[model samples]
Target chain A: MKQAKYGLLLYIFLALPPVASLMESVMIVHMHMQLTLLVLSGFLMGTFFKQRFASFFNNWNQSGVPGVILAVVIWAYWMIPRIMDETLTMHSIEIFKYISLPFLVGVPLRDSWKKVSYTVKHILYIFMTINFIVMGWIYVAINQQICNNYLLVEQRTLGFGSFAFAACMIIYGFIWIFSERKEHQQSS
Target chain B: MEQTIKETIRYPKKLLGVNPNDAKVSLAYLSVAFISLLIGGLLGLVQGLERAGLIELPSWLNYYQVLTAHGLLLLVVFTATFTVGYQFANLSHSFGGLLPKVRTLAWVGFYLMIIGVGMVVTMIVLNEASVLYTFYPPLAAHPIFYVGLVFVVLGIWACCLGVFINYRHWRKNHPGQVTPLLAFFAMGVFVLWFFASIGVTIEVLTLIPWSMGLVETTNVMVARTLFWWFGHTLVNIWYLVATSAWYVIVPKIIGGRHFSDKLIRLVVILLVILNIPGGFHHQIIDPAISQSIKFLHVFMSLSIAVPSLMTAFAMFAVFERTGRKLGGKGWLGWLKKLPWGDVRFLAPMMAMLAFIPGGAGGIVNTSNQLNQVIHNTMWVVGHFHITVGISVVLTFFGICYWLVPYLSKRKLTPKMNKLGVIQTIIWTVGMMLMSTSMHIVGLMGDPRRTSDTTYGGHEVAASWIPYEMVFAIAATLLLIGVIIQVYAVFHMMFLSPKGQTEFPVAEPEEHAPVAPLWTERWGLWTVLLLAVIAMAYVVPIVDMIMNAPPGSPPIRTW
Candidate 1:
C-alpha cells in the first residue's frame, strides 16, 4: 500500500516538468505545483508513516552494507558521466538519485535498524562525528569564498545558529559517551 | 495497563536534596535579567520618543546605540538568564536521582553568562560593537565583544555539560533503562546545541584570525552559512527545551498522562535533525546558491512543519483525554476540565494560546514565495517574538514557577504567584497586539533594523504613523507586564516571609505499580524509529555532494 502511494506521488511529481511547458501564462505555476507536491509527500510520510517505515527497516537491518552499496551506486552514476562524457541532466539526476537512495537504507532495515546494542550505537555516533568533522572543515575553508575576505571571528565563536546546535550536540555526545563508560565501569 | 506503569516506579529518598539557598541563587538570575530588561525598556521608551521626533536626550545617545543595546541586552542577556535559571530548577527535579552534577555546574554557568552579558553591554555603551545582537558578518564588532560572547557560550556550554553529565550518570546507574520523556527532550536540546555551536565556532575561530590580521582574508558566504547554521537552529533549540517543560508541566496540571509520550519524544528527535538542514531556507534569496539548492532547503523547511503539527496533535490529545476523565463530555469537555483558575495551569495555557498565531506565521514564512514578502521586515520580528519570545519565554516562566519550589523546598509567596500569572496574561495579550501591528506595517513595506526612516520619502512614512502609535501603546503594556513579572519573582525570593517555607516531601514509589517491561521496550524502539525517519530527508541529500552540474561552483577541499 505504501509502495503504491510512493509510486503515485513520484509519477505525478516527475510528470510536471513536461506538463509545465504546455502552459503559457502559468508555466512557472505548474512547475511550482509539481515541486510542492513532492515536499508535501515527504512531510506526510515523515510525520505519519515514520514509525512503520523505521520498524520495517529495523526488521531487515544488515550492518549498513546496503547503505554503503546504494552510496556506491550513486557515486558510480556520477563518476560514469565524468569519465564517459554521457549527456544527461547531471545536477537534476544527482538530486533525484539522492532523494531515492533513502529507500535503499529505509526498506531493508525496518524494525531492527536502530537496536540499542552498544556496538550499533557506537557506530552511529562515530559516523555522525565524522560527518560533522568533514562539514566543519568544509565550512572553515569556504570562509573566504563565502564571506568575501572577511574572517569569521566573533563573540560566541560559533555564532548564534551553529553554536546552539553544536552546544546541544556536544551535550548529547557527552551524555551518551559518559553514560556508556559509567555503565561499563559498573558492569566490570 | 495501570498496573504496568505502577510497577516501573522508583523513588529514592537519598536524592531528595533540597537546599534553601538555591532559591536565592535562582532569584538572583531572574532579578538581574529583569533589571536588564528595565534598562532596555527605558532605552526603548527613548526610541519610542525619538520616533515622534521628540529627542529629550542628547543627540549623541543616538538611535543606533539604543537599538543595539535594546536588542543585545534584552534578547540575549535577559532572556537567557531567565531561561537558564529555570533550567537549574528543572535539572534538580528531573535528574535529581539520576545525575547530581547539574546544580553545581549551573551555578558556575549562570555567573559566566552574567559576565558575558556585562561585557557586551559595556561594548554597546562604549560604541565599540554596534553590529547588533546578530553577529552576521562583514560587519564585525570589537574583539572584546567576541571575547565576552565566548564567555557566554562557555557558560551555556558548562550548563549543558552539567545536564549531560547528570544524564550520563543516571543512565549508567540504570543501564538498559529508557530515559524519561522530558529528560530526553532536554537532552535533545543539548544535542542540537552542541552541533549548532560548531558553525558559529567555525565563523568565530576563522574570523578572529583574519580580523586580527593573522589571516589574509575570510570567506563571507562561508561565514554567513555557518552563522545561519547557528542562527536558525538556535531558535529551535530555545523553543524545544522551553516547550519540553510545557510538555511535562501541562499534562500533570491537567490531571492526565501524556497522550503519547513515545510519539512526543520522536517529534523532538525529528526536530533536531530537520532543523539543522532547514536553516539554509534563510539564505534562499542569496545569488550564489543554485535554484536546486534553494529548492532543497525550501522542501526541508516545509517538512519541518510536520513535527510542530504533530506536537500540537499530541498535546491536544492529552488535553482531550484529561477532559473526558474529568467527567466532561465531547470536544468542549476538554476545555472544561482544564484548571482555568489555577495560575500554574493558566500560564502555560496562555503560552499555548500565543503559539497558535506564531505557528501560523512560521508556516507562512517557511513558504518560499511567502517568505519573500516578509523576510527581513518587522513582520519577521513579529513572527519570532510571537513564537520564541512569547511562547518559549512564557513557558520558561511557567516552568520556573511550577518547578522551582519543588527543588528549593520553599513555596512561592501566594500573592507574588498571583501577580506572576496576571503579568503573563497581560504580556501574552500585549505581544499579540504588537506583533500583529508589526505584520501590518511590514506588509505595507516598513523595513527592519531601522528607526522607521527610509529613502523612499514621506509617502512611505505617512502610512506608518498609525501603526507606530499602536505599537507604542502595545509596547507600554508589554513592558508593564514584564516589570511586574520581575517584581513578583523577586518578592517571592527575597521579601517573602521565610517562616512559611514548605519542607521537602519525598513520595514513596515502592508501592506504586510499574509500567510493563514490554511497554517500555516498545517505547524505546518507537523512539528509535523516530530517529530513523528524522534522518531520511537528510541522508538522501548527501547524494547531492557527488552529483553536480558541469561548470557549477566547485566545493573547495578543506
Candidate 2:
C-alpha cells in the first residue's frame, strides 16, 4: 500500500512540466530519464497493481509471455528515430509517450515478470542489455541531427550515458553470477 | 565396383552431426555467395584497370554501372549471403539440429534473395539502372531496382525470423540453460540486420513509388539520411559475423582455448547496440543537418570502435595463450609459432593485422574537421578496401577453406592447400600496394567515383599518373589471387578425395556448467535498446519531417 502511494507520486512527478521539459530538451536525459525513468515508475506501479488487483492480473497474464512481449514491442516502437521525433513535435504523441510507458509497458512488465519463467526472464534481460548498447552507438556515431530540437553535444552525452549504463548493468550481472555460483558451491 | 561407386556417391546422414537436409541448405546459401564473389571479383578487376587508365570500358558498359554492380555484389549480396550460410551452419551444429520448419523457411529466404539479386543484376546489365550502389536520389534508378532491393531485405528478414523461431524453440525445450555462444552470435547478427535494415526499408518504400512516378518528387536529404542509417549498420553486420568466427572458430583452429565467455558476450552485446546510429558519421559533410548533430555523431562513431578494440585484444590474447602452450618463449615468439602455413589461420590472421590500420583510418574519416580533407576521395575508398575488402573478405575466404571441406565430406588436396596460402599472400601484397597508392593520391586531391581523372589533362592529373600505374600493378596481382582462390574452393568442393571432416569447437580454459542467467535475458535488453534508439533518432527525424525542403524531381546524369 505504501509502495502504491510512492508510485502515484513518481507518476505525477514525471508528468510535471519542468521534468518533462528537461527530458525533452536534452537528448540523453530524455532517453536516460524520461524514457527509462518512466519504465521504472511503471515497474513500481506494477507492484501496486499486483497488491490491489492480484486476481485480475493473475488471470489475465497467467504465463506472463503476452504482457512481457507487449512491453518489449511498445518499448521498441518508441525507439524508432521517427517516433522519438514525434514526441516533441506532436502533442498527442507526447501524451501517449508518458501514459503508455508507465501504464502500458511499466505496469505490464512488472506484472508479467513475476509470472515469467526463469529462462524467459533471462532472455529478456539479455535483450535489454543489447538494446542499450545499440542505442548508445547510434547516439554517438550518427553525424547528422537525429533529433532536431536537441543540440549535438546532448546527443553525445546521451551516447556516453548509454555506455555507462550498459557497463553498470554488465558489472551487476557479473556480480550476481559470482554470488549465485558461490551460493551453489556452499549449498552443495 | 558397383558397391564402391554407391559408397562414394552416397550422402552422409550427418555432416558435423547436422542433419543432411540442414547441410544442404547451408551449402546452397554458400554456393550463391561464392557465385556472387566470382562476379564481383571480375568487376573489381575491370574497375581497377579502368581507373588505372589502362583499359577502356566499352561505351555500352558505363564505369558507374560496373562500380554499382561491383559494390552491390561484393558488399551486399556476397557478404550477406555468406554470413547467413555460415551462421546457419554454426547455429545448427551448436544446437544439435534446427527444426525442419526453420530449415524450410531458410530455403524460402534463400530463393527470394537469389531472385532479388538476379533482378537487380539484370537491370544493371540492361543499363536501365545505372545509379551507383548508394542510389542516393535525385539520381533515380529503375523502379525494378528498388523493388529488387526490397525483395532482398525481405528475404533477409525472413531468414532472421526462422532463426528467431528456432532460438525460441531451443529456449523452451532447454529450460534454465544458457544459449551457446555461436547461437547467441547468430541471433545478434540477425537482430542487428533486422533493425539496421529498417532505415533502408523506409528508403525503398519511399523511393520505389517515386521512381515509378507515383510521386513526382522526393526529398533528397531525407532519402540520403535513411540510406546512411542502413549503410553504416550494414558494414557492422559483415564485421560482426566475421568477428563471431574469430571468437568461436579461429581460436579452436589454432589449438587455443576460448577467451573468457563473459567478455565475448559483452563484446557482441556492445556491437549490436552501438553499430546503428554511427551511420550519421558518414553524412558529416551534408548541409541539410546542423554541425552540433554531426559533432554528436563523431562521438558515437568513436564508441563503435570499442567492440573492435575488444576483439583485437581478445584475438591477441588467444594467440598468445596458444603460442605459449606450444613452447614459444619470447614476446614475439608466439607470433612465429602460429600456423602460418595453414590458409585457415593465415588468411584471417593477416586480415586482422590489416584491420588495425583500416580501423584507424575509419576514425580519421569520421572526424568532422579531418573528414573535410578526405571525404569522397580515393582515401575513403582505400580505407574500406582494407576493412571490408581485406579484413572481411579475407576472413570469409578463411572460413570457406575449412567450411567447404566440412560440408563436402572431402579433404582439401595438399597441392591446392599450399596454393591457398600463396593466394592469401598475393592478396595481402596486392592490397598493400593498391590501398597505399590510393590513400596517397587521395590526399593529393583526387576525387572518388569519377570515371576519368584527366579533366582535360589538368596539372594535378599529371601528378596522379605514377600512383595510377602502381594501382594497375596491384590490381593485376589481386586478380591472380582471386583466380587461385576460386579455383581452390571449387576444386575442394568437387574433386578433393573423400575423407572424414572435422568441426573445431574451442574448449574454454575454465569451464562453467551453465552460463550466468542474466546473459540470456534478451527481452529486457531489447526494451533498453529501443529506448536508446528513440533517444538518438527521435529529434532529428522529426525535425527532418517538419522542416523538409520541397522534394526534387529525378535527374539522370548518366
Candidate 3:
C-alpha cells in the first residue's frame, strides 16, 4: 500500500509538463531515465493491483511465463526507433506510450518477477543484456540519425547509454548468480 | 556508573589486543605520515610568508614549487598514509590479525609510495613540475612526475587488494555473522579508494604519453572531468575515515554506546554510491558542460548531504544519550558531562564543531551561482582549510593521541594529554584566523594560487595585503602547532611509560536490534555504484569527446 501510494506520486510527477519536457529534451534521458522510471513507478503500483485483484494474477500468471512474455514483447515494441518517433509526432501515440509503458509492460514485470523460477530469471537477465548491447552497437555504428526527433550526436549518446545499461545488467547477473542467491538458499 | 572496557567489548581477547607484527605495519605508515606533515607544514609556512610579501624566495625555491610540494605531501601523502595506517590497524584489531599476504602487500605498498614520493619531490626541486596538486591539463609537468603518480596509484591498488582479500577471507570463515563495524568501514574505504583511483589512473596514464610527446594533444575538459571524479571522492574518503573514529572510537572515549549499526552502514553505502557523480560540482564554473547538465548535477551533489546530515544527527544523539546516562539533567546540561578534558575527546569535539561552518561553505561552493563568485578564489582555499585542515586533520590528530600510544604499548600520560589539548587549541585558533582572513579577502576579489598578492599596486589587491599578513602570522602559529604535535607523537611512541593501552571500539546498546543481513550485500552495492557512475558520466563524457575543441598542446607557463 505504501509503495502504491509513492508510485502514484511518482507517476503524477513524471506526468507534469515541466518534467516531461525537460526529460524529453535530451534523447538519452527520454529513452533511458524517464522511460525506465515510468516502468519503476508501475512496478511499485503493482503492489496495489496484486492485493486488490489477487485471483486474476494467480489464474493468469501462476507460472509467471505469460506475464513475462507480455512485458518483454511490449518493451521490445517501444525500443523500435520508428515507434519512438511516432510518440513525438502523434498526441494519441504519446498518450499510449505513457499508458502502456506502465500498465502493459511495467505491471506485468512486477507480477512476474517473483513468480518466475531461478532458471527463467537467469535467462531473462541474459536476454536483456544482449538486447541492450545489440541496440547500442546499432545506434553507435550508424552514421545517420536513427530517429526523426533526435540529432546524430544524441543518437550516439543513446548508444553509449545502452552499452552502459548492458554492462550494468551483466554485472548484476554475475553477482546474482555468484553471491545474491546464496542468501536465498540459506534462508529458505 | 563506570563501565570497564573489558565488560563493554564482547570480542575475543586475541582480537582486542594489538598484534605485534600488525603494530609494526601501522607504525611504519604513521611515521611516514607524521614526517610528511612536518615537511608539508613547513612548506605551507614558507608559501604563506611569500604570499604575505614578507620574504622573497631564493631563485630555486619558488612559491609555486613549495605550494606544489605542500599540497601533494599533505593532501595526498599525509592524508592517505594516515588513513591506510589507521584502517589497517582497525582491520587488524577487528579481524584478530592481518593475513600474512596482506602484511606483505602493505610493505610492498609502502616501498612503492616512498619511491613515488621521492621521484615527485625531486621533480618539484628541479622546477620541472610546478603544476599544482590538481595537475590540470595544458600545464605539462615532467614525464617522470606523471610516472611517479602511476607508481603511487599502483601502490594504493596493492593495499586495496590486501583489504579485499582479508575481508573475503573473514566472510568465508565467519559465515552468517555481521562483520565488525570497523572492518566494514575498512571495506567501504578501500572500495571507494580502488574505484575512485580508476578515473585518476586513466588520467595519469594518458598524461604520461602526452607529457612524453608520444601523443600530440589531449582533451582539457575530458582530463579535468576525469581528475575531479577522483578528486571529489578523495575528499569524502577522508571524511569517511574521520567518521570511523567519530562513530566507533568517540563513543567509547566518552563512555557511551555506539549508534545503530544499520544506520552507520547505510551512511557508508550512501556516501559511496552518491559521491562519484559529485565531481560535476567541482566543474560548475567550467565551460563546455551545459547549464541543464549542471542543474541535473545539483541533485547528485547535494544527495551526499543526506548522509552528512544523518551523521550530524547520529553523533548528537549518541552524545545526548550518553550524557544523560552519566546523570546530566535538563536539555543542554548533558554537554558538560562529556569528557572535555581528555585530548582524545577534546580534539575531535572541536573537529566536529568546525564542520558546522565547513559543511556550510561546501554547500556554497557546490551551487552554480555561488561558485561563480568564489571559484578559484581564496575562499575555496579557506573552505578546504576548514573542512580538511580542521574537520578531518584534527580528527586524525585526535586518533593519534590514543592510537600511537596503543600501537607502542604505552599509556598516554596526563602531561602529554595536556600538551595535546594545547596543540589542538593552537591549531584551531591558527586555522580560524587564516581561514577567516582567506574567506574575507576572497570575497574582496583576491585570486588564489598566485604568490604576487599586491597585483602590481592595484587598489583592491592592496586592500588584501592586511589579510595576507594575518594569514602569514597564522601560518607561523600553525607551524609551532605542528612541531608540538609531531613531538607529542614521537614522545607517545617511545618516551611514554610502557603500559597496555586499549583500542577503544564502542559497543552497541544491548537492547538495539540486530543489524540486518542485507547490509552485507557489497556486490549489489558495487553494481549500483557502477550504474550510478555510468548514469552521471556517460552522456557528458560522450558529448565532450564528439564535440571537443582542438586539443591543447603541452604548455609551460613558467
Candidate 4:
C-alpha cells in the first residue's frame, strides 16, 4: 500500500506535460528510459489492483499463459515504428499508450509473472532477446526513416539504442544461466 | 559459519597473521607502490619549483614531461598498485588463503603492470610522450604509451578475474552464507575498476592508431568523452577503496563496531551503479553537449553524494556510540574519547575531515554555472589535490601503518607510530597550504597545466606568483613527508621488530539483522550498472559521433 503512493507519484510526474514532451523529444529516451520507467511505475502500482481484483486475475491468468500473451502482444505492438509515430500525432493513441502500457502491459505482466513456472519465465526472456536482435538490425539497416516523427539519424540512434538493450539482455541471460548451473552443480 | 571464520583467523599458519606466500605478493606490490610515490613525489616538487620560477629545468628535462610523469606515477601507478596489494591481502585473510591459481594470477598481474609501467616511464623520460594523465586527444602521446596503458588495463582485468574466481569459489563452498564484509568491499572496488577501464581501453586502442599516423584523424569529442568515462570513475574507484578502510578498518582501530552491515553493502551497490555516469559532469563546459543533457547529468553527478553523506552519517554515529560507551559524558564529550595519538586512526580521521571541503569542491565542479568559473583552472587542480592527495592518499598512508607491519610479520612499534603521526601532520599541513593557495589564485584567473602564467610580468599575474611560491614550499614539505612515509613503510616491511600484527576488521553490532540475500546478487547489480551506463551515455555519445566536427590529427604541442 505504501508502495502505491510512490508509484502514483512517479506516474503523475511522468505524466506532466513538460516531462512527457521532454522525454518524447528524444527518440532513445522515448523507447528506453521513459517507457521502461512507466512500466516500472505500473509494476509497483499493480499490488493494489491485484488485491482489489484478486479473483479476476486468478481466473483469467491461470497458468499465467493468457495474461503473459496479452502483455507480450501489447509490448510487441508498441515496438512498431509506425505505432510510435502515430502516438505523437494522434491524441487518442497518446492516451492509449499511457493507459495500455501501464494497465495492459505492466499490471498484467506483474500478475502473470508470479503465476508463471520457471521454464515459462526463461522462455519469455529468450523470446525478448531474439525479438530485440531482429528489431535492432531493422532499425539500423533500413535506408529510410521508419518513424515519421524522428529523423533518419534518430531512427539510427534508436536502432543502436535497441542493440545496446539487446546486449544487456544477452548479458543478463548468460549470467542467469551460468549462475544457475554453478548452483545446480553445488546442489548435486 | 561466523564461528568458523573467527577460528580461521585465530589460528592461522603464522600465528594469526597472513600466510607468508600471500604476504610476498602484497609486499612486492607495496614496495613498487612506495617506490612510485618516492619518484612521483620528487617529480611533483621539481615541477612545482619550476612552475614557480624558483628553479630552472635543464634543456633535457621539460616541465610538461615532468608533469606527465608525476601525474601518471602518482595518480595511476601508486593508487592502482596499492589498492591491488591491500585488497588482495584482505581477500586472502578473509578467505583463509588464496586458491593456488588465484595467487598465480596475482603475480601475472604484478609482472604485467611492472612491464607496462616500465614502458610508460621510459617513453616519458625519452621525451616521446608529454600528454598528461588525462591524455586528451589532439595532443597525442607516442603510440607505445597507449600500448603501455593497454597492458596496464589487461593487468587489472587479470586481477579482476582472480578476485571473481576466488569469490565464486568461496560462495560455492559455503552455501547460503554472506561474504565477509571486507571481501565485499574488494568486490565493489574491482568491479568498478574493470568496467571503468573498458572505456579507457577503447579510447587508448583508438589512440594507438591515430598517434601512429595509420588513422589520419580522430574525433576529439568522442575521445574525450571516453577518457573521462574512465577518468572520473577512476577517482571513485580510489574513493571506494578509501571508504573500505574507513568503513571496516577505522572502526576496529578505535575499538568499536562498524555501522550497519546492510547499509554498508547498499552503499557499495549504489556507488557502483551511480559512478560511471558522473563522468559526464567533467565535460559540462565542453561544447556540442546540449544544455538540457548537461542539466540532467548534473543530478547524475551529484547523485554520488548520497552514498557519501550516508558514510559520513554512519561514521559519526559509530564514533558517538563508541565514545559514549568508553565513558564520555555530554553531547560533545564523546569527541574526546577518540584516539588522537594513534597514526592508524589519526591519518584517515584527517582524510574524512578533508573530504568536507574536498567533497564540497566536487559539488561545485558538478554544478553547471559554478563549473563555468573553475573549469580548467588551477582550482580544478586544487580540488583533486585535496580529494586525491589528502582524502585518498592519506587513507592509503594510514593503511600502510598497519597493513605493512601485518603483512611483514613485524610490529608497529610505538616509536614508529610516533614518526607516522609526525609524517601525517607534515603531509596534511603541506597539502593544505598547497591546495588552498591554488584555489584562491585560480579564482583570480590563473589557468592550470601551464608551466608559466606570468603574462610577461603583469600585475594581476604577479599576484598569483605568491601563490605559486606557496606551491613550491608545500611541495618541498610534501617531498619530506613522502620520504618519511616511504622510510616508515620499508622499515616496517623489513627492519621492524619481528612479531604478529593483527589484521584489524571491525565486528558488527550485537543483535544486528542479517544482511539481505539480495546484496550478494552481484550478477544482477552488474547488469543494472551496464544498463544505467547505456542510458546515460547513449544519446550524448551518439550525438558526439553523428554530429561531430571534423576530426583532428595528432599534434605535438610541445
For each candidate in turn, the TM-score is 0.72, 0.77, 0.97, 0.96
Going through the candidates in order, their DockQ values are: 0.07, 0.06, 0.71, 0.52
Identify the runs in model 2 with alpha carbons over 4 angstroms from their true place. A1-188, B1-18, B511-514
Please report the candidate that would top DockQ against the real structure.
3
- TM-score of chain A, model 3? 0.95
iRMSD, all candidates: 11.3, 7.2, 1.3, 2.1
As a whole number from 0 to 100, the lDDT of residue B255 in candidate 4 is 91
lDDT, candidate 3, B1-558, per-residue tens: 335543323222453235677888888899999999999999999999999999999987788899999999999999999999999999989888787788899989988998898899899889999999999798999999998998889889989999998887777666677899999999899999998999999999889989999999999999999999999999999999999999999999999999999999999999888899899999998898989989999999999999999999999999999999999899899999999989999999899999989999989999999999999899999999999999999999999999999999999999999999999999999999999999989998889998896767989889999999999999999999999999999999989999988789999998998788788888888888898888898888999999999999998877
**Model 3 residue-pair collision total:** 0
- Summarize candidate 1's per-residue lDDT along B255-327 as a digit string, tens digits: 7665455566667767776777667777766545546546656767777788888878777877777788888
Which ranges in model 3 have alpha carbons more than 4 Å from their true place? B1-18
TM-score of chain A of each: 0.40, 0.89, 0.95, 0.93
Task: For candidate 1, give the lDDT of residue A34.
Answer: 34
After TM-score superposition, what is the CA distance of residue B66 in candidate 2 from its true location, in Å?
A: 0.6
Question: What digit string (tens of lDDT, one per residue) describes model 4 on residues B56-163?
Answer: 999999999999999999999999999999999988888887776788999999999998998899999999899987887999889888888988998999999999
lDDT of 2 by residue, B186-232 (tens): 98898889888888999989998899888999988888888988899
Model 2 docking grade: incorrect
Better of 1 and 2 by DockQ: 1
> Tens-digit lDDT track for model 2 on A1-188?
67667877888898999868855766666766688788888888788788788888878888899899999999988877677788989999999998899888999998897688878987887787788789889978987778777776667666666666676567556645644444334435
Candidate 1 Cα lDDT to native: 0.59
Lowest lDDT 10-residue stretch of candidate 4 chain B = B9-18
